[model samples]
Target: MESMLIEKSIQGDVASFEQLIVKYNRYVYNIAFRMMGNEEDAKDMSQEALIKAFKAIGQFKREANFSTWLYRITINVCKDEMRKRKEHVLSYDVENQDEGSMKENIKDESTNPILIYEQLELKETIETALNKLSEDSKAVVVLKDLLGYSYEEIGTILDIPVGTVRSRLNRSRSALKSILQVQLAEQ
Candidate 1:
């Protein structure tokens, strides 16, 4: 079903493309939001990525996973925007995300107020640490840990070898751990 949609989409069928969008929109938007750290920018970047994907559908090779290709486009779009802005301080935009969005998935199931507060604090600290990473490191961490992509899938998306993906993820995790330890100790 997906291959048929991809084929029709490649043939310039808008309806087919829309079907693909329906299936992947949440994933695309979540990545954008995590990268951009804001609702507005995420929306804009996701839209731009989708437009780019539509325009370049013809260039998409059938051997590659369409979602991986789309993820690459989304990451590039966010990275380009971040480069243009010359900023790396990404904050969690949990307050602004609509209900039932990706934010819900990260929400603590506990209704205890203290646990909720602690969770939000930890989330903010993690976001702060993530913001300090280089874009390449951040991308690897996001793809591997946050979005649950396998090493091979991350390698394909980032066009890097699996070893490189593993190394980057390792370094990024170490950095995040150090940052969190320091921040938590200071609190």
Candidate 2:
């Protein structure tokens, strides 16, 4: 069914493309949000990536994984925007997130106001640290840690070797630990 949609999409069928969008929109938006670190930019980048995907559907090989192809496009779009801005100080707009989004990850602790506060604080700190990372390192961390993609999968998405992925993830993790330690100590 997905292959059919892809074929039709490649043939310039807007409805078929919309069907594919419906299936992958959340995934694309989630990656965009993580990379952009804000809702507004995420939405904009996600839309831009989807538009690019629609335009390049013919170049998509049938043997390749659709999600991976889409992810590469999304990441490239976000990275291009990041490059243009040349600003790493991203603000994670937690208050603006929908109830069903990343906010849901901390919902289990909501019953305890203290835990909720602590969770939010930690989340913000982590997001801040993540935003400080280089685009390459952050992409590795977001894909492997936050998005739960395997090492091989991340390499495929980022067009890097598995060893490179492992090394970047290691360095990114160390950097995040150091940043978190300093942040926690300051509080």
- The number of the candidate with the highest TM-score is 2
Specify the highest-lDDT model's number.
Answer: 2
List the candidate 2 regions with Cα displacement exceeding 4 Å.
87-117
Q: Give the TM-score of each candidate.
A: 0.79, 0.82
Count clashes in each candidate, considering only residues at least 3 apart in sequence or on different chains.
0, 0
Per-residue lDDT of candidate 1, residues 1-187 (tens digit): 9889888988999999999889799999988887777789989999999999999998999899999999999999999998888744452322232324332433443342324347779888887767666677778888888999999999999999999999878867766655555455556
Residue 110, candidate 2: C-alpha displacement in angstroms: 30
Per-residue lDDT of candidate 2, residues 1-187 (tens digit): 9999999999999999999889789989989988888899999999999999999999998888999999999999999999899754443322222324333443443353333347779888888778766677788889988989999999889999999999889977766655554455556
Q: Which clashing pairs does model 1 show?
A: none
Poorly placed runs, candidate 1 (over 4 Å): 87-117
Positional deviation of residue 87's Cα in model 2 after best superposition, in angstroms: 5.4
TM-score of 2: 0.82
Worst 10 residues of 1 by lDDT: 91-100
